[model samples]
Target: MASFVFKVIRNAFGIAEHVAPGLCGRAAFELFCRTPNPRSLTAGEQRAVDQAARFMAEARRHCLTTRKGRITVFDFKPQGGTRPLGTILVLHGWRSRTEYMKSVIEGFRDAGYRVVSLDLPGHGQSSGRRLNMALAVDAVRVAGEWFGPFAAVAGHSFGGAVAVNAAVGAVAGIPPLATARLVLISAPSSMPAIFEDFGRFLNLGPRSQLAVAAEVERVTGRRLEDFVGSVQLATVPIPALVIHAPDDREVSADDAKAFARAGDHVRLFWARGLGHRRILFDPEVVSEAVGFVTARPRLARVN
Candidate 1:
């Protein structure tokens, strides 16, 4: 298949191996600090954003664990009713903090599920030299001890890759992350493609793409996109709910459709005009995600 061949070629050239370790860390930090072009934020809109984030910081508790060493988490404990219908582990998109996605965390919780969220390495509470695939998975798995056998794991944008890396594969020999289902919000289909798209967005040159591949390779110990089938994920086998907005400027809807087709268990819900990050706030969007997840029941932890 074309995908398989791409995987082989991607690894051979070290597409993500253009530099020494941790370069992506530096790159990601620089990207995160730059203020996005603010688009018409009414004072009310800004305060609403601030208030929601404030709630999470005040409401959630921190849990730390050691995988690669001391991972930090913001976990919302079940409000003590039937062991929480289920716990939803949430991963935020690139260059965004966990607080910005409060609607997602609150959506799962309001629907009667516990929630665990992390600022992926180099992003939020977790200490990191950089943000890469392996560290991403390591952060989730370490937090897994506190949020074991979750009902489903959900991620948006780049975090979608982290969700897959954690749920379907064994990281550093940590007990395989156990989750019954998956939810990908604006998740991309391939890392090579993600790099290309992001590179174009940032106006990155060939050197930038090469630097990304190199940094990703260091963290994962393999080609960045080689993870296409690292677990059953390249062809997701578990129940997966994919939510994407047609108007997303960051990732292509066609790619999401392609990724959705890879899994028989995947159910795709396309929104007519929701923008990338705004998808989290759309009632119609949240309604679908919460419905899909809550429809599934719970079970005890395996290990």
Candidate 2:
């Protein structure tokens, strides 16, 4: 009876944590970005924007053999003579390809960091036929090696969860733990809640959601609950920037509050207007992220 009561309470809390209203506008915003402007901009302006997008999409499609097997990685390096501020390893969200993170790479490039990213095993150019949360975590673990010690990590949505996993050293085989800074953009802290959300997206009732979740876990050998990638912000000594927008329709804005509860080393940046996908390119966010990572510590004496 005690176990039953605890399970009930746990399930209720999980539901309330990551899922909520405001999802429509988030969906609408994503739709709008893909809607296309249909207006003529200057040739130079269009070329720069489209080329940056192309660099992210086309430049890194080759497969590399890793311990986990042949995995797909999309690596973007800065132009010659562009000294790297640091290395950045990007992880893509569920069902999204590495191309989706072009804005993320763009921000790091502007900061002069070489961005190395992968299509998280089951998505994009990866070889897997099925996408699972654990594979995303696995991709982060193996891919971190390529970025080496001098690196910062960031991700979006499911990818952000993987970043959190990588930062906290939960995903095996990554290194320089306790030293690497982490950036989580619109990350969800709970996994079961997201599955519950997959049901809501289809308007399925409680029973069907639970049933489908169980079946998925059994067939894939990966339980979404088991792969819940929320980082223990309190345990980490490294500085972390957690960014989320309340206007976000995908992941709840309340997650920002949960992250703030992690500890003093964690900084929460909440902006309005930018949706989940487009938030990667928001100029204000780019500035904030660069500033946070590059800022000299208060203890450092200025020359």
Candidate 3:
């Protein structure tokens, strides 16, 4: 099959690249910064992406240009003459496009909230091929300005990390973006942890890891700790729901625990069997997110 051959070729190349240990570190760093399989949608998947993009575009749509590239945004106002509670911004994770978040989008729509989902730069239909936490945060801020007054933001995986940064940054009065609620699904607590894991997975040496770290710092202008979602959550006063599955193969469930421990305003929920990607599609998970975003507070607390 085509997929099998592709995997074989990729694996062979990977083995050859790692065989020479001296050059392996540098090679690993290159791989670390690059977005592997930049285009992964099959014919059917591509069609789905096209359909979703078209649906979102039927509403108000525009491309916001950033320093790095232009970000495609879809903004849908609420229907049926019922004033929208507020708009909810949804962000997808690494190597994922907004189309993959159909469940979340529909969930918010059914709950009478306007939804805005953008293809982060370097993913989906957006421009660029490399991604870093710092660039992603900047792109979100730009998008927030164009699509002002978000009631809440929900993100999965890497996007969840960005959502945390956006929320905390807004709380800190950086760029003046405001959101009343935050939801993080299967998000990594620490970027450094992910970097180290990637290094081990690729069999990179300590020197290579250091090189990768330096390269990341150079690109993002911030240390790995500065990007950790848990660290940002500690200062975020908005209500947050951290959802994770025990069977998730990528980010650990402990990251959700860290989010919960950061503040009483944050809550942790466990969903079984959804793994990493499916959690975004699970109806129950989407319902929980919708509820959190729309819920009336029992008491008002000043930030």
lDDT of each: 0.67, 0.62, 0.75
lDDT of 3 at 254: 83
Q: Which ranking of candidates, highest lDDT first?
A: 3, 1, 2
- Where is model 1 more than 4 Å wrong at Cα? 1-49, 63-70, 79-82, 170-175, 197-215, 229-236, 296-303
Tell me the TM-score of each prediction against the true structure.
0.73, 0.68, 0.82
Candidate 1 per-residue C-alpha lDDT over 1-303 given as tens digits, one digit per residue, 9 for 90 to 100: 987875664453343335522454346424533333333355765676577765676555675755554555777855545368878888987666677778788778778788888777666555554566666787787777776788888899888867776776734454458898888888876766766665654445465566666665655666666665223464448777778888988888875677666655667788668878888777777777778887742221111
Top candidate when judged by lDDT against the true structure: 3
After superposition, which runs of candidate 2 have C-alpha atoms over 4 Å from their true positions? 1-53, 57-62, 66-69, 171-179, 199-231, 296-303
Across 1-303, the per-residue lDDT of candidate 2 in tens digits comes to 987875664464345334632343233223212312223335754554466664765454557664444678776776554978777777767646666677777777777887787876545556655444445555665665555553677778877776775566553344423336777788887766766665554444454455555554553364546544433667666677777887898888777667667777777787568888778878777666666677632221111
- Candidate 2: what lDDT? 0.62
After superposing candidate 3 on the true structure, give the runs of residues whose Cα lies further than 4 Å from its correct spot. Answer: 1-30, 36-40, 50-54, 170-176, 296-303
Residue 172 CA displacement from its true place in model 1, Å: 6.0
Angstrom error of the Cα, residue 221, model 1: value is 2.2
Weakest lDDT window of 10 consecutive positions for candidate 1: 294-303
Task: Please give the lDDT score at residue 252 for candidate 3.
Answer: 86
